[model samples]
Target chain A: MIELEGLTKRYGEKTAVDHLTFTVRPGIVTGFLGPNGAGKSTTMRMILGLDRPTAGDVRIDGRHYDELKDPLTSIGALLEAKGAHPGRSARNHLLCLAQSNGIPDRRVREVLDTVGLTAVARKKAKGFSLGMGQRLGIAAALLGDPRILLFDEPVNGLDPEGILWVRTLMKSLAAEGRTVFVSSHLMSEMALTADHLVVIGQGRLLADTSMADFIARNSRSYVRIRSPQRERLLDVLHQAGITAVESGDGTLEVDGDKAEHIGELAARHQLVLHELSPQQASLEEAFMQLTAESVEYHAHSGTPVSPQQWGDDWKKG
Target chain B: MATVQVVRSEWTKIRSVASTVWTLSLAVVVTIALGMLISALARSEFDRMSTQDRITFDPTFISFAGMSLGQLAMIVFGVLVVSNEYSTGMIRTSLAAVPQRGTFLFAKLAVATVLGLVVSMATSFAAFFLGQAMLGEHRASLGDDGVLRAVIGGGLYMTLIAVFSMGVATMLRSPMLSLGILVPFFFLISSILGYVDATKDVVRFLPDHAGSRIMQVVPPVGDDTPYGPWGGLGIMVLWVLAALVGGYVLLKRRDA
Candidate 1:
């Protein structure tokens, strides 16, 4: 178990991580979600004692990171893919790390095979692609088979198959009763993998809840109804004391899971229903809603200005 | 964790990279080869020298002249050993494996310094013998007074140079920045300062100048240096200690 209590880090006047207190428990994948420039990376660094926390404590198995004997055996981390020296062979890279923690040499080969890099074990890391580099990093993290594992942006450069493989790997690792904490900006990816979520925005905690609960609380689930006798259906819904808002596409959207009630009411009134479906907001929309106020770098969505506008602005300047 | 494990791990790290082999090879080859070339030139030109030049000619010191240039390679080796961790983003992983910063830094330095000592000793011995062979009748043997000490000191000098470079590299944490400052400071600035009468006193305190004094078996004409060979080496050791301590303090205080 990894416990962070009042973990904080600041750079001059800028607070990179602010009072981040969350416990990553065993036997579950805890997704660390945030917008760009959030404190996910900084928080991970502090957990490993790579960055000195401004005012707080992080403990692995109830001991400070530095106090843990052979800390790799307690908590393994893949902070970045380019953690290996480009000139060193993959085998040697893992070998050195293993030796540092008193892990045997055979484990290096085992991790290499586990990551599917055994064929290129002797090759230097400079030749490896982004996906291969990520694999090597994961191999290093798994070298000691620690109870807690941390991966930052693990699937950033992976292909579809590689992404699936990483998802499976993370899930299996957690299933072995290990604490798996992964950080990513990809909400869709987290929805598929993460069992629990600890979300932050602009260095502040926004939500800490289970995957299902988070989406349910932050988003709206509504039932959409379409009928041939739209006027009659509207009257029936109103008479039944249910509010229905007309959608832009000529369908009525009721702000609750009233699909069954609405269907029975329409049938009782001899209303011919064309479509009746309930829509639960996806995790993506929930994340956007939760973080919309705190996103640091916002990209405005619109068409580009025409050349004439650019010319006119230039002339005015 | 035991310090021995970290030491062994650091050994693996140093030997696994091609830079270690290439840099040390360059140091040895350049030192020995250039020493021979200069020794050969000195032998042929002995007849044309003035009386004082011939009187003060120290064959032991002459053979080790190649270190003036060869030590640059040693510097590169030392700098890369420490700074490559930072440059390649490996320091985070390394520190994660062994979270004790002092143990990690010192173990790495110890391993690199031992390797530097071995290569420097081999190069020192080879340069002396081959340089002496080229000098022919002007050769200085191990049996000669102060000759063995000077030869051994030559090895110590090169090793100290590499160690000093490692200390500086640890402080800088960037190979390019470390090399950019170290190479020119040792090669040009120190030399220029030593050449100018106004700055000669300051230059003697510099790490390279004080350390290289160990190679001198006989003083130059009109020699008035305040420190003996051992004293000069002591000064250099102090410089190395200062650099290492500064590096350690900074590394402890800063984020990885």
Candidate 2:
């Protein structure tokens, strides 16, 4: 269990992390979600006591990080992939860390095998590929078999197979009643792996809720309709006290789960409907809408067109 | 955690890297090989020297002549032992494992210093025997007055040079920047300053100048140095201590 209360970090005139307070509970994979530069890395560093916090407190398993004897057995972290000496072999890198905490040397070989790097364990880290380096980092994190594990951007450079492997590993680790806290900016990835979500935007807490609740609250679900008798369908919808929005592609979108009602109405009027499908907003859209105002860097090319303009242009046509 | 565990861990860290072996071996090989070459050259030119030069000539000191060039390798070893953590982003993982900053830094320094001392002692002893063989008739034996102390001090001087570099590297935190300043300061600037009458007094206080005094078993014919061999070493130790304390203060106060 990792607990943070009123955590804040500032650099010169800029605030990097602001009053972040959240408890990462055990028995689940809690996703720490934020845009780039939203202080996820800074917060993880503070949790590990690598960086001094400007204010507030952070604790792992009811003790300060530094105070914990054999900290690896209490909490293990993979902060970045390049955290080992480039000239040292993978086995030696793990050995040094294990020896520091009085862990047995035999565990080094075990972890190397666990990460599937045993064949290359003797090779220097400077020669490892990005995915191989990441595996070595994960091996380091699992060296002591700690109860709490923290991973930052674990899937940054992984192929699809490697991604699935990590996703399954995280789930299994959580199932074993360990607190698994992983941070990433990929909402679709988090939607698949995270059971709980703690979101931040511009260094402030945006949401702390279950994954189901977050997606349900932030996204819009609607019924989409396309018909050859578009004008007749609009009149029928108006008389039925239903408001439908016309999209640029000539599809009508009603803001509710009214697929059955629309289908019944079309059947009654015998309208020649071409397409009728229910659309629920994806986690990507929900995350974008929630963090749109707080995104630090915005690309100017091909910015999304406003929906109000779509309405105005439709009325003009 | 016990300090012994950290010490063991630091030993593993130092021995696992190729740079540690390469730098220390380079220091040893360069010191011994060059010391023998210089001794042979000095023996050949012995007859051309003035009467006063022959009377005050120190054979033991001549044997360690290669140290002037070899100490740079020691400096490189010292710098890499500490700065590799920063250069490769390993410091974060290291500090996270052992969060007591003082223990982490000191254990690392202690392990490196011990290795430096062992390698340097071997180099010092080997250089003395080989260079004496080259000098033939002018060789100083271990039984001569102050000869053994100077030989032992030669090893200590080399080890101290490496330790001093380690302290500076900790304070600077970049291998490139530390080497950039330290290499020129010791190799070129200190020697140049010692040669000029204007800067000779100040040069005596620099780390290399004061530390090298320990290996001198005989003073020059018109020598006027204020400190004895032990006193000069003491001054160098003071410089090392100050650098270490400064590094510790900065490390404790700053964010990693």
Candidate 3:
């Protein structure tokens, strides 16, 4: 487990991370969610004892990372994709880091094979592509076979197959009772992989809860029904004490009713329904909603349109 | 000890980098080859000169003429060993692995010292043999007066100079800056001091000037400021120690 208490980091007049206190528990994948520049990387570095926290401390498995006699065996991290030396061969790179923490030399080959870089292990890292470099970084992290793992933006440059591989790897790692803390701005990816969520905004802790609980509070769910007699469907929903809004597509968006209940109501009303589908707020929509005002860097492309405006055409039956 | 581990890691790191091997190889080849060329030319020139000018032909310094040029290559080798770490961003990984800043510098110096000794010894030996062969009948055997002394002092002195170069490299992390400062100090300041009578007293104590006294046959032309061969080596050793301490202090006080 990794624990942070009142952790803070400031750069002169700017605060990078502010009073971040959270426990990243074991046996599950905890997603650290934030928009760009929300201090996820800063917090991870603090946890690894790379950056000195301005106010408080972070501990891994009940001890500070540096104080641990062999930290690599307790916590593995890929804080930056380019952390490895470019001149060293991938194998030698792993070997040096392994030796530093008393890890056996055999572990280097194991991690290289595990990451599917065995064929290119002898090649210098300067020749690696972004995805290849990310794999090497992950290989280094797994070299110690530690109980805790931290990855920041692990899937940034991966292909579809590589993305699936990373997602599965993270899930399996958590299933083995390891504490896996992954930071990403891709909420869609995290929603599928992370069992729990810790959302931060502008360097402050905004939410820390199970993924289910987070969605329940921050996301909205409803049913969309389009019928020849849309007005009749609306009337039936209002009479049943269900709030229905007339969507831009001329459909009745019925809230407070499941898709099954809405279908049964339309059947009873003898409405010729063209469409009846359940719609839950996607992780992307929810993320945008939660972090709208707190986004650190706003795109200056003039007139920012809402996500709903962009996705409304696809919402039509 | 963790320091030993760091030293081992540093050894692996420096040796693994291709430039380390290349630089050291160039230093050896350049030293030996240049020593042969200069030795042959010196013998021919000495033979052609009038007998009156032959009094200045002290063969000891002539045999090690390569030291003047070879030291430049060794200095380049020394600077790159440290500066390349900074250029490639490997220093961050190294520092992160071994967070004790002073210990890291010690390990780096230890690696450089061992490498310096090996390269210096190899180059010195090769240069001496080639120089001796080029001198023909002008070459003095090891049994001659102070001949063995010059041979031993030649190799040992070169090693000390290389160590001094490595120390300076550590103090100035930028290889080019160290080279810029080291070359002028060796080729310019010391030579200009040699032409004058007054400043020679202080300038002889400077790193290269005082150290090269070990390789000379006569007592540094005309001066009472001359130290014994071992004493000259001691002066260079002092310079190395002082550079190392200053490097350590800077490392400890600065952020990586």
| DockQ for all candidate structures vs. native | 0.76, 0.82, 0.31
Docking class of 2: high
Each model's lDDT: 0.91, 0.91, 0.78
| Clashing residue pairs for model 1 | none
Best by TM-score: 2
- What is the C-alpha lDDT profile of model 3 across A125-178, one tens digit per residue? 899988888898889779889999999889988888889999999999999999
- Count residue pairs with overlapping backbones in model 2: 0
lDDT of 2: 0.91
| Candidate 3 stretches greater than 4 Å from native | A222-278, A295-317, B47-58, B67-69, B140-206, B224-256
Instruction: Sort the predicted structures by lDDT, highest score first.
Output: 1, 2, 3
TM-score (all chains, Cα) for each model: 0.92, 0.94, 0.80
True contacts kept of each: 0.89, 0.87, 0.20
* Cα lDDT, model 3, residue A211: 93
What is candidate 1's lDDT per residue for A104-152, written digit by digit as tens? 8999999999999999999999999999999999999999989999999
Candidate 1 chain A, which ten residues in sequence have the lowest lDDT sum?
Answer: A296-305
lDDT of 2 by residue, A217-256 (tens): 8678999999999999999999999999999899999998
